[model samples]
Target: MNSVNSSQNNLLFTSRCPEVRDAQWVCQKVKNTFPHISTTKISAKMADIEEANWDLYRKFIDKPEYALLYNKNPKDRKFLRLFAWRRRIVKRIHDARESWRIGGKDDYHRVNNVLGQFKYDKLGNCGEDAFMAATILRINGVDNTCTAGLKVDGSFLDHMVCVFNKDGSTFNGKPNKNTIIIDPWVGMADFASNMFQKYKNVFSELLIGIKPQSEITFRNVDEVGISGMERFLLIMKHPELCYPNSAREFMRKK
Candidate 1:
């Protein structure tokens, strides 16, 4: 039945149909992007959620989530930390195993924003991995940023990680310095570290000590694969690089 024009439930009318449709849309998007059932199932679960659950669903949004990450509430900050991570890699993996293994494969995709559940999450999928990581890091007072980076292969715009202006330098919240591109989402660390050491002058030319800006582009962080885990290992293997300050010196000038 058509919803009434004067209805107070505008959210219920036009938006409701699309929730189911979006689930269908997410299914199509995921299926088209990833062939394996393991990867594509995320879209399937996203499709299955009840429209009323949208409120909870939006909490998982990186766009709003990032803006709110700095809210003064200690509870909000702490929620980001505990759910993000209170332990190290080996321990995180151990704790995550039971949860990941829960419900067999189905629970994996159903697991959102809850930390350490998905393998691709390690590569920084947020709801899958990166989001959880950033949430935890922020809570720990590490100062982090979550944004998206396109692979430049195919049209898929993937998620990536970055440290905020302050976290990357001793400068503290001053964005004028070069913000490092740490692609935790893909494990890219995507900076040209070697090139910087070689050019050296690119240092002055690159960052110019100008306040840097970063963003997520609003795409939901959902990529899943073993590659994500590989990237996670690579990052853990290099805490100095992951630390943000060391990385800030190398954002590509051009």
Candidate 2:
């Protein structure tokens, strides 16, 4: 059974999806063209690459089969309990584990922070994708790039993305015009101020009854001060800590 599962996973990864291929192409193109660019040009070009990665990821997940399997529609809650949904979800989780294990041998149980591993596998949910996007930005000389996620009432809201502090300004209660957010999961990258509006207009279906910016605390993963392995173990033990929201509490307890 293990061998059969491994074979199936190998086929899944070996046969590159079109979206994954396109994302890799964009990454390679950026790497090739980046060296000849000026500082100002580099930022714009890097944004394009980040946007392209986000677009491809969106395409990958928006496919009917994939979307239906992971449907979040409130009306689908009953259907989700059905064996068909359970089987598919379980299979996906298994596949993700296999991919993570093979790609991240050094950190098998932790999030794959190595860029090469992510590029090779091209399979992860929001958190991993956010980490990949932030790493890409940093590698290309972008500063203050970090993974950020929302927290409400001391619990994580199950979303994360790459945030760029373009002007090194601290985020207070209000959105800063210079704050850029790149969400590969949702296929958007814009100023934090503009993104708040887009969150309502564009991502309303996914976000649903969006919380006010003041109520939503954006936690940067870098500030968590825990090793990836330790963070992973903490989340495994206290699943509430799986999201970025629980990081502060975990630190406080430490």
Candidate 3:
């Protein structure tokens, strides 16, 4: 394993940060958005969810966790979906988006800190978005399970994505088959519904999915725009690369 200090110094202009700041941010979002939720004990209703529920997911997320259809799940489901990737999913995601800002929305989000780029293009910070998304969902009631590993088709490297589930309460008990994965960056609520007709839609599986359509846009870490979701349909339609173990084979891999 690599020392956290050796990760990178891309954001020398920034100050020190906590290892789990992202997790906290996620929790914050959940609290703010789902004002009605007071740590309620939502019975694990994985069965209530169906294949058509994904459309509702887009409305909750104001910006980007870059979540995909498969990523989001109830707490119980996250465990069943995540195998070895569970222990560090929350940590890795929070760390991935750790950084400082440089400019404004007009300017592209520059790298203040980073470990590796998915394709060397900047669409705000993917890791931060995922961390924020997962944290918010976890706190609000959605159980998000993710994986930090190589993609099977040589489309990308050192990647992470959420998988949905039926139940999502870690404190309740052992893991269950209630989680599923989603790429937060894939869908933009601002776009026409038909425009998003293609591209894998995985929101329907969860009790609730969040996307703030009115607040969707790519963010510039430096300026007045610290909030927004940059649409990257190009990612799913055409990924860069993946390893021999694609997500579909995640459980069966040797």
RMSD each, Å: 21.8, 20.1, 23.1
- Candidate 3, TM-score vs. the true structure? 0.24
Task: Show where candidate 1 strays beyond 4 Å.
Answer: 1-113, 119-127, 149-156, 167-177, 188-254
What are the Cα lDDT values of the candidates? 0.33, 0.47, 0.28
Pick the winner on TM-score between candidates 1 and 2. 2
Tens-digit per-residue lDDT, 1-254, candidate 3:
35344323312311232212222333333223322211111212422332234343333233223332345667524433332232244344344334333242221142122212222222223343343344333323333333222222233332233232333333221223332233343322111121112122333222122232321111211111122232132123223211123343212212
Task: Please give the lDDT score for candidate 1.
Answer: 0.33
Best by lDDT: 2
Q: In terms of TM-score, which candidate is strongest? A: 2
Model 2, global lDDT: 0.47
Candidate 1 lDDT, 37-140, residue by residue in tens:
12221333334452434543355344445624665667555544432332234355455555565654532233332333443434213223333333323332
By lDDT, the better pick of 1 and 3 is 1
* Ten contiguous residues with the weakest lDDT in model 2: 33-42
